[model samples]
Target chain A: MKCARCLEDTAAKVADAPDGSGAWEIYLCSRCNYSWRTTEEEEVINPEKRDPYFTLDGVDMDDLMVLVPVPPLKK
Target chain B: MGCMPACKFKPLNNKRKNQGVNNLYRDLREFLAKLEEEGQLVRYTDEILPEPDVRHICRASGDMPNGPAVLMNNIKGYKGKRLVVNVHGSWANHALSFGMDKDTSPKEQFHELCNRWDNYPGEVKFVDNAPCQEVVIKDDINLFDLLPLYRINPYDGGYYFGKGNVISQDPDEPDNLDKENVGIYRMQVQGKDIIGMQALAFHDISIQLAKVEAENKPLPVAIALGVDPVLSFIASTPIYYDQSEYKFAAALNGIPQELTKAVTSNINVPAGAEFVLEGEIIPRQRFPEGPFGEFPGSYSGIRKQVRIKVKAITHRKDPIFENLYIGRPWTEADFLLGLNTCVPLYRQLKETMPEVEAVNALYQHGLTAIIATGNRFGGYAKSVAMRVASTPHGISYCKNIILVDDDVDPFDLMQVMWALSTRVRADKDVIVIPHTPGMPLDPASEPPGMGNKLIIDATSPAPPDSVMREVRMVDRMPQALEVEKIIAELQKSAGK
Candidate 1:
């Protein structure tokens, strides 16, 4: 019902829900366009399944850091 | 100390919020729809449970899509709360939220951001208590009760705070000092009394946290639930020790970000903020924290973490909890916070290092910076490269830095590497200094912030007395006309 931040205005929608259930209202001001993605009341959010964080070892940071090799210079 | 001038912005309540998905809601919501329309947001209404296994779905999809946003409608716990995932993870999405073309380049966007932030309002106001205070959960607080705090990745020891901003005060400075700073630190929830907070060593926030520990004092901080979006950029904005986020947020918002006195401690919270966690880090409260995935594309196994005593919990009647995932590219952490702040940094670097031409937050803001400079002499590119990895604006977020010459686009690594391969001789052109320093999440280095980094100079070699080449062909007119037709055709095809 109430908004976060200003806590004055009413809430409308959720920005990002890890779980599919909880309501994360989009906090915004009708005037300044100061908007953010947050969930005020996260009763139960069904977060999407993810991989093991350790899987990062499966790939090299260098490889991921550099998506493509920079080509050599031209004449 | 002065009030920030006003801007044309207004909250998107009645005018922007609640509009039909088709009528086009605010910039952020519309972008969310675009992600759906583009099939980027996988509408997973699957009957999923809130087990750590839930992370499998996102990992199974490979890396998150860079162009379109991701939205999951069906969830297991807290059925009343709706969740939206990965909204500001890529440049495309962040651009759309701020009313820019999805394809807007980082160089252009960062320049605009610095300018827009300059107009940020600093005049602050306050209310006794706001949304975050609406529902008070004092004392006997158990964060697990805030369900859905599951592990986001395989390496992660448990659920972590990857995207949210951790607002803390600088302890080295006087409590009431003018230079109060607030930074976005990764708070990985380790246990009931402890959360692993990765405050980069080079940063002031971490230093302050250390100071409190030195004297065995609890560091009080407010983890904002739902405040304003610009606060993210503000959190990422470089600070001069103990600089109040309110001042920077005020300037960034083009109006003062109102503050409310904390009920549990002597901290100021944004009046508009949703949930405010009034907690203190008991000195030397250490625990095993991570093994969580980070931007450097890796996760460091469990390590000693910090402690945060939950003194009070406040939020709106139906507060929305914000969370994000790491361990891969295209997370909002990479997009909005990473690349979002790159170009402006390149521009800022130029004031001190003119040779610095361009910089970009590539692969989700992990350094990978592509620069273009006219390296006139020996070490010209090296000096510039070093600064890229060490400067508060540059090195603070970099895991790997690649410096190029004027000919490189900075946006295109292919161009930068081409310059490196040809112009730079391995030992001569490449500058790899170990312990280059970076974020704690960079698992490749020493623990978190204590690590080394490498910088490769990809600039072209200077001419020995300069030999002339064949006369270049100038086809500007034809090129412009050809590009014009392609743009027109694409616009018409997309029905724009």
Candidate 2:
């Protein structure tokens, strides 16, 4: 399977799923160095992302939020 | 009305360095600009409620890598004013506030903090004119009508200054920083002219108040809000009674803190503060204070504490209101206290066992820790672990101590868990201390200030080469890179 993030085909089985039924697979792109969990549909579809002000509580977002800079104080 | 010209020290270079930061920013605004420069500050324009939305944003951003401090400019009721929260919520931000690179590790940060403690000298220089005095209101003032103090939680007693750092001095020695006490105490707005302050019986401020009360004198205080981040961290730290936080702040900022007299009291306040509440806590009076959310993720039930009778309110023309929210594990309070708390414990352990590599405080109020050290003897691990569990004030509150070998990274949760699983024997490694000094906010403490402690020696007992649990290591180039390439291929094969 191809990586969802970088559209690369470097996917492999990382571990067995918690129920031992579905195997957990991960896709890592060498170009951008982005890693995605293939077994978890959320990380693939709606991966945790930072908002300008808030991230939904209880969700661990991977990216740090970027803030707009205000005018600096002078000496 | 303004700062003295002589105290205006030049701002230091912003370049990343190893020896620590040189100069403190001029004021809170300049400090916020520095956080913005480092990409550690975030702004929210959403018209949020006063209760949970603003607090939720702080918790979410505060739990991240170098915690992005949140600035909420669009509150439901307050339009022209801004509320800055979680400003010191990340490890990287903590280092940045004190003049270190944003990438400095906890161990290196600790070393720099200690070095500042050793060599930095602090002085409090008075100024004549200050911004905090730009607008003074002494009469016909109602707190609810004048300021936008939010009720963060449902069961909170009332609106509060969650991040107000109180500055008080010994009545006898009112001018010296040595007798000055600065601490972050929760202030519940009890009325238009009064606020209930919780100075826990164990705090130095409480001790100072007790001394003043014996002589039947009101302890004068100045509550400072929206000061620079470095001073805020210093106030939140569990500085020893004899050590002055103001001096330490000056040292960290590389200049003397500009002080100005409060309108209602003689106590000196940071001249650059956005706002200052001048008041006095009467000697024998007590008022109902809390039922407010505490740092330990629980409500500190109602108790009668000291009451501050606000006599004057002074602030900058267009002041920004600053706050810190309690409750939950990884909020700003935890990060602020965690960074400073480790320094004291390190000093305590290093006095005898200089082999201690580093200490990592975990969760709210540092209730648990992972200590890295060299196991010199079979029982040396337990002995050091005992000191970690029993040390007074800040770290003594750390009830769970996990001792690991020097090779293990204390900040890595998985590595700590692995050490616990492999090196620790349930019966042999666990040592329980029955009764010890405790944190009042801990929900599990039996008598509120007393609790049991557990020390797990996670260090290996086997010889260097002989290991009980076999471990497999992965190489970086072919094995890891090939896995990444495989995952990329898999994602590509899967539909868009």
Candidate 3:
């Protein structure tokens, strides 16, 4: 399945209902880290139904990533 | 505008003096019971989808006048699970949290909270056992199974624990009670046992993490969920770095806060909390987190934040999961942080400037603050505004400071707009200082954490700075107070 936010096909099934009920499944995108459950609304799970404003298509993931520099270890 | 009569004010409901009951709730369930008894909570037992339905109800509650806190019991795919939202979403609920009359106005609540804040460093009672440890999961810890996790906003990257009272201590001063910090930060459930926490550079947790990371040691933490209402409020408050939040909670409630040691760490969490997830922040590790809707009404961009590996989960039987819905302006996030935000700024300003009357930092967590103060001299209002920008929370959040005459009620936006319309002269009243420290979540910040700060002095001219000609101000009629009292009596008799 494709990620709803970034349209990436790297989404993978992460977990099922702990009850082993096959009631719902959670999927996480390896590319953008977006996670959603199968029971979510179409707007959240379906890429086509996603809001364009939140879509990360054509945007560089590196540009959006904020890497806070780790402070140096004490000597 | 003419000021109202002083007779309109109602006597504060001082529970401590009248009934000897200080609004100290032992647990979230006790508070929820009080909310239900007072007609401030709505419960749903119908089976509802986890997504959209829960959030839509919560979002709609913010639009109602003093909306009720929503409790959902029967969520699809999750059996015997309970979730609550908007627990502190309205002024009425906020007042009720303090055991005050539900009709208490925001201005009155502010004064009551300030009065309680004066009695700082209250007592804390340590305990050997707590209800939060009734059910402990040491192995096969899965957050998805433990929590009824659901996304608040459609664009949010993952389900977040938005209201957990995260307890941690300074690694260097591990035994110092004062150095222990209990704060609330957005925690994203990244995996079954992995969580990503947004620990901003300025956050107290970040300071503790730095000390541990420098030595390549994991920082133990306890994220307490469904805590007492007052504990949540005190956790969100920006107090001194060394001040203990449990003590603050004690002071706010006029009683000793009860705390218990975490299962795996020395951190003390509220003994009455419903759940406590014991974990440790992996040293020098970062994980992709966020794109979550923040209190600023904007989605904070994804960032590589500190990662935590959950080792255990302890909870009361059938624990209730509490989460906050933050989207746009005036959600539960606003009400939760509103008056607590104002009291701090008011105290800081009143310390040096006695003429400072009131502070309303309810908007976007004091990104913009409206301060009412009596001017001591010309440009004194501007000086007060500058001081606001330097306060602990203000350093990063107070980007726009609006100053008004002491008579103006800063809590009332209409009164504020009147001052802005009549008192402001663009050329002289506006002061802009660029390239100042700001909150990164602010969408307007250029470099994320840096931006311009603005101060608008709306007070009338004092001695030595008369920009406009003196005009006689209109005053209320002498009989206005008597007439208002008569009308109030008539309305009461008519059941209006």
**Best candidate according to lDDT:** 3
Question: What's the distance in Å from true for residue B457, model 1?
Answer: 2.9
What's candidate 1's i-RMS value? 17.6
Clashes of 2: 29
- For model 3, how big is the iRMS in angstroms? 2.1
Per-residue CA lDDT of model 1 for B1-496, tens digit only, reads 1111221111233432222212222212334556566455555566564444346554544354453444454455545443445556556556544445556555555544544545433566777756567788876665645534545764354456665566676665445534556667677654443455655456666676666666667788777755555566666666555456677655544545667777877677766665677788766544444556776567665445455767777877655555565666655566656544564566456667766655665554545566666677756777777776666756656656677766566766676656666665676666556665555555554544555556677665555523225345333364675798899888888954
Say which docking band candidate 3 falls in.
medium
Candidate 2: Cα lDDT at A1? 51
Give the per-residue lDDT of model 3 (tens digit) for A1-75.
887778867788887876566779988877777789998888877878888877778666656554456778878
Off by over 4 Å in 1: A1-75, B1-46, B52-74, B172-178, B191-194, B376-379, B393-400, B434-440, B446-453, B463-483, B486-496
DockQ of each: 0.04, 0.01, 0.56
Worst 10 residues of 1 chain B by lDDT: B1-10
Q: Model 2, B1-496: lDDT tens per residue?
A: 1111111111222343334455667578888898998998989887775545676787788777777888887765556568898888887787788778777766566656665665446777888889889999999666654565665654454567888989999766776667688899888776666777888777878777777777677888999999988788888777677778778788777777888888977787889999898889876756445557888888775555678888899999978899887776667788778767776676667667775766777456568878888787666778888777656654448888889976676777787898898788777789888887677778888677778778898987644424447666442353675688889999998996
How are the candidates ranked when ordered by lDDT, highest leading?
3, 2, 1
What's the TM for chain B in candidate 2? 0.85
TM-score of chain A of 1: 0.25
Q: What CAPRI-style quality would you assign to candidate 1? A: incorrect
Per-residue lDDT over B1-496 for candidate 3, one digit per residue giving the tens place of the 0 to 100 score:
1111121222355453212237557789988999999999999888887787888888988768999899998887776788999999999898888877788889888877776776788899987779899898999887888788889887888999889888999998988988899999989988788888888888888889888888889999999999888899989998889998999888878778988888888888888898999999998867678789988888988888888899989999989999988879889989999998998888888888877888999999899999998889999999999899999999999999999998888988998999999999899999899999989999998789998889999999798887577788787476886898999989888954
